[model samples]
Target: MAEAFERGGQQAWFHDHGHWGVFFHTYDNFQLSGFGEHFDQPRKIHVFIPRDYEVSPDRYSVLYCNDGDDIFFGDGETEQSWQVAEKLSQLYLRDQLKKIIVVAICSGDRHYEYSHIPEDDGGLEEYSRYLAKGLKPFIDENYRTIPHSTVILGASRGGLAAFYTACKHPRQFPQVATLSPSFWLGLDSPSYSMSNLDKAFKIKLQNSALMFALTSTLLEPDLRPKIYLDWGLRDDPGNEYEIRSQCRCMEMIQVLTTEFDYQEDHNLFIVEDPNGSHSINSWGDRLPNILQLFFD
Candidate 1:
């Protein structure tokens, strides 16, 4: 496979031209790896271009998906996948959605890179920089995409990454979809060095609530990205982790509705599925609805 572009694009494979819409491209490294970086693994980017891309001169909207592994191919850890390319193709064929490009950015150290806890091995700052600064510029330069039409999306840890990235860089990602986000992770105290573990939990929740308030305040009221958040009621069933996560998710929803002043079914859309769980398949099942909510 030859390097596809000046920056580090290597074509993963070639398909019969104009037949399949999905294309795979790999980068040698996440761009700007030397600037206070820790995770610098090879990046695999899967792009889904609508079939009309070649036939029409029109530029399409872009959807920047995290967890590229779960998007088309399972991450090799499970037999589940989102098949996002196939879904977009179906929607395009049915004329139910406007043409859009899907840019799925695969994860490296998923837990570390997707985390917001800067005190931990969290590399979210670097990872989001790669998305908003590095990858977006590269994609825009290479593809016929609509300017400022990018939306970020993910599930689980990737969901946390997407939400944080959008909140921090709303201009780059003006819309976001977070499905079954691991909100429990954020609920825990970010500091491992804290002396009191019990008090840390309460303090963390209070601080997190305050952080959300600050998050809303920092984001210009007009520039706040449209947010789509969802979680399954039975995410982990009997697991305490899921219980905390669901509670935290609801709490964040409350903050967004009240503090952020987001109107339901308008700029803010949330879904609570009674039967939904924290699995790739569950997130996959909910993806089309998310796409419809944002892109349709």
Candidate 2:
């Protein structure tokens, strides 16, 4: 269990239990100049390249994950990461999942990068541009990847961005996983925090309507991504927000199944955690399930 450490502007580590290795590289400011002009600064990119990457010369599916820092480093207080590398190693060794490349794109100004509200300066469109145009090209050129099997994943606001990006560009990303998305973003009132308790029911209704409208208007059945969504019942302990979030998730599931006619446990899967909370740990706990659904 060798701990990861930064050296020479990169974080590198090898798992003693498996042959796979994880590397973190920094893309300097304006390095992606020609890719997209929306984001102007540098970004730390985490990549997990399997051991057989060089020996096999086989093309593998790619999972582009958002909130790279949280996924890799974990929260210092809890030491709970997505445990992506370790889990991928185990799954591959067991022949449960194929050897896939993971590209974890670190967040830069998440509030801006992951936002999806059309009226707000969410930078989501720009972020998608960076992924579809810049990052994807770089990875595909540098590593062997299966273009058709690519998947996009993220949690919370990042989840929102992942779904939005997939909807907008189905040809590039055909699979997606969203964990506890903040679908309540645009519906929030100016005094949302103060009135959250009283407005829980109202927020749920609003979120349902908004999700329906967004999905119905933007998503086409023929181009929909293989989607996975999950939310915790106790997401925000003692707060009504979690319930509202769950409601929103349910609404999205309803629309997907009924409107889009996506069959459950087929092209669409939804997991509801009865005792789960909204945190990296919760997401980590469910990562195995998601991987099985998407990659198994």
Candidate 3:
């Protein structure tokens, strides 16, 4: 059963960045409406504001990202951080991209919370409601965000979460970027064998959040969010499982283009990185392009 869509009236306070960096404001142990009942604990929310945000009167587009610790403030050397502040600073300084605010939601029990399909034991729908009904409104109320101009992004399992959230709540997130998403998740087997490729593909297509959203009579094509997908050709090197997963990703892209009529270089953007790997660095490397595609 789906939980009631509700928002916590509790106010969250932001603290100094301290070691994180200048552009970030940290909100520790921030509790969302339904998260306490559904999740393990309150999540740490990080907001990245543009450098001149205070002086400027202009509102900014918002980027909501999963895996806050990895994306926003992981240590530079040991951890493969996305370096969102670094990249955003550079882009803003160069005037290459629009001024944007980033809201990073930290993960807790990520494997469970990020799962999309019913076969997977998780609170994906609850999590999605938390974002759409909980976080977005909070951010809008406190921050100067341009209405209806929000994008959600994530990689791997986080990518799956982002995709599902955007599909379920398109009005809240009109643009979404998924890097090497784990679409093969929740299948009978974690990895697909060559002989069972067809079966896996059918199951995925039938159960896909994107498919459900698009096929619905209520959703118009224009209301569908712009989708960006990227995958590394060398994600798992010679592993047969990774290769088959990559093939599935390609098939999904094809279906989006041919069946859904999502035009390339427009609503749909795909990148196949030959040198990319299934790691934070690779996703970080590709993020700049995504930012440009959506915000520039």
Instruction: Identify the runs in model 2 with alpha carbons over 4 angstroms from their true place.
Output: 1-30, 34-38, 75-80, 189-198, 201-219, 235-241
Runs with alpha carbons beyond 4 Å of true place in candidate 3: 1-22, 34-36, 39-41, 75-78, 191-214, 217-219, 235-245
Which pairs clash in the backbone of model 2? none
What's model 2's lDDT at 293?
76
Better structure of 1 and 3 per TM-score = 3
Can you list the residue pairs that collide in candidate 1?
A: none
- Two-way lDDT contest, 1 vs 3, winner: 3
Q: lDDT of model 1 at residue 162? A: 88
When sorted by lDDT, best at the front, the candidate numbers are: 3, 2, 1
Q: Which candidate is the best by TM-score?
A: 3
Candidate 2 residues 139-201, lDDT tens each? Answer: 787668888889899887888888877876777888889888877677655345634546643
- Estimate, for each residue in 181-294, the C-alpha lDDT of model 3 and write its tens digit: 877676436655656766756665545554564455214586777899888877354444445546657877877777677888888888988978777887888887888988
Residue pairs with clashing backbones, model 3:
none
The alpha-carbon lDDT assigned to residue 153 of candidate 1 equals 95
Candidate 2 Cα RMSD after full superposition onto the native fold (Å): 4.6
**In candidate 1, which residue ranges exceed 4 Å CA deviation?**
1-13, 16-35, 39-41, 189-206, 209-219, 235-242
The model with the greater TM-score, 1 or 2, is: 1
What TM-score does model 2 achieve against the real structure?
0.82
